[model samples]
Target: MEKETTRIEAFSDGVFAIAITLLVLELHVPLIEETGGGNSLLKKLVAQWPSFLAFCLSFFSIFIMWVNHHKIFKQIYRRNTPLMFANGLILFLATCVSYPTALLSSYYHTASAHVAVAIYTALFVCINLAFNLLWWIASQDRQLLRPEITDEGIKRIKRNYLYGIPVHTLAFILSFVAPTAALFLCVALWIYWAYTSGKLDLKSK
Candidate 1:
């Protein structure tokens, strides 16, 4: 019999879709007809700077999560119930990130922004933890993982999670004391991820 698709995979896809869509909703339609000029339209958009910032961060965060999830799933041949559930938790946490991101953009430079950033970073760390748990279970079971993948490759994957969690945790804490610095650190982290993803051994299978 063909193996049934797991709940986790389906739920993750749904959650990611929702999260990305929610981000765009933050953008308001410009009342350009009232202003009646291209310059006015541009100025209206510029005034909603918070929405633009939210859109950028939300888009990047959703895309990164999707890319990372895709890479992890590509190596798996099948999924068990527990694996599916673990992935669901990760997706749930990921979904929560959008709200905080929106809040951060709207209330940035205020105490609310600190809370929002902290929540966003916490969601990220939780998702990573869930991924770590899912990976550990799959690696321990062996059957779920691709046969040709090396222990070293798996270790490297785990290492990525290890590093990501702490960095995010630190950023979360720092947001209260220095939100701007924390944000800059996160941007730097993403740049590092861009470089590292290029270096990952795609031939690990």
Candidate 2:
């Protein structure tokens, strides 16, 4: 099980790396000729602020998810088919982020902005649900977790994972009424997770 866990983690890491790397592809260089001159190129680049913002938000969200995934696996001593599939679901949603992120950037301040932002937020909600399911499966019966992992620790982590769902759901809900605010909340959530890394840290006595 340990060997299998290692392989799964390795594969997951590869997926995360690929997903994060793909975000940069959405940021294209402005063509000087199309812009009329090099001076106007600067303005074109500046106009891409939405792209840059979306890239940063998605990049950090994936980064935080990767970190939490790594932490969860550290406590896992075994894996099963269900857990593997759940993890795969999480990765699939994460990889899908690039597309919605591109949409959000392209449709920013347009009629379609709300749809794009809602889609992006909805993807995150699914991703968070996947994480919660994966954790629940592994922590059940205490069969897959390391012996040193305390029940308190498991509960804490579960609470942390569970909290993400509604926050993201709220963001998705707000996306319809206020897209920019929804995006800001999403970014803020990721920032909160990044800064609260210690909350997920499990230590063995």
Candidate 3:
């Protein structure tokens, strides 16, 4: 079980790495001709603000997810069929991140900006729910957790993962009318996860 879980973690890391790397593909070089109308290269690069912002947000989002995933698995000593499927769900969603990121880069300045950002925001919602489900499944079987894990620790982790669902859902709803504000909410959530997730007490044996 230990080796199997370890392999899954390694595979998941590869997926996250690929997804983060793919984000850079949307960042195009500002061509000289594209900036031919008396526009400087710096100005053209600056005009691609949406691309840059999307890349940064997606990159950090994937990076932080990988961190929390590794932490979750640390306490999972035994595994089950449902646990495997839940983890697979997360990896699948991780790969899908690049698509919405590309959408943002392509349409964020146009009338479709709301749609693009909404999709991007919605993806975050899905990813968070997947993680919440994964942890819930893992916790269902106490035997799956490390021997040292306390009941309080389990409850704490559950509460922490639950925080994402409603927050992301709110952002998703706001995406339709106030996409920029929705994106700002995503940034805030990312910051929240970065600081709070590491505080989980689920330590491995």
Candidate 4:
């Protein structure tokens, strides 16, 4: 079981690395004025707010997903077929998130921006769903969880995941009317996770 889990971890890590690389491909050189020198080029690039915003959003979103995946596997000492599929599903959803995030950033002021946000939120929802499924499947047989894990720890993790998905999804939904405000809320939640997960009490063995 350990060997199988290790293989899954390795394969997933490779996929994640590839996904992160692909996300950056969306950023490109902004068109600069022909006569205006270095200052013009810099100003043009800075004016391309969409590219920077998309890059930041996608990078952080993927990073957080990777962190959560690491946390889940840390708690699971073994693996089974269901866990394998669940991990695959999570990766699949994660790969889809970048495109929508980029799309939303590009079309942020347009009428179709809402659709992009919806797609982005939906992909994250799918990711969280797969996460929950993997946790339940692995815990059902006790084949994946560490033997010493407490029930309360399991409950806390589940609660954290459950609470997070809705907040994230709703933030995306609300981007239609108040995109800047929604984006700020999303950033706040990301900060919360970063700080909370770093706590000694939240660390898993």
lDDT of each: 0.73, 0.89, 0.88, 0.73
lDDT of 2: 0.89
lDDT tens digits by residue: candidate 4, 125-159: 67767878877787687656776677777777777
Instruction: Flag the better candidate by TM-score, 1 or 2.
Output: 2
Candidates ranked, most accurate by TM-score first: 2, 3, 4, 1
Q: Model 2: which residue pairs collide? A: none
Q: Write one digit per residue (lDDT tens) for candidate 3, span 140-194.
A: 8888888788888998888888989999999999989998999999999889988
Off by over 4 Å in 4: 1-4, 31-38, 199-205
- In model 1, the worst 10-residue window by lDDT is 1-10
**Residue pairs in steric clash, candidate 4?**
none
What does each candidate score in C-alpha RMSD? Answer: 3.0, 1.4, 1.9, 2.6
Candidate 2: tens digits of C-alpha lDDT, residues 53-155: 8899889999999998998888888889999999999999888999998998899868989999999999999999999999999998587888788989999
Per residue, candidate 1 scores C-alpha lDDT tens digits across 11-111 of 67778988888888777787757559768877877777876876787688677777777677756666788887887777777777668777877788466
Candidate 1: regions farther than 4 A off: 1-11, 30-43, 198-201
Error of 2 at 36 (Å): 2.4
Those runs of model 3 whose alpha carbons end farther than 4 Å from true positions after fitting are 1-4, 37-39, 203-205
- Scored against the true structure, residue 183 in model 4 reaches a CA lDDT of 70
Candidates 2 and 4, the one with greater lDDT: 2
Model 4, position 43: C-alpha lDDT score: 73
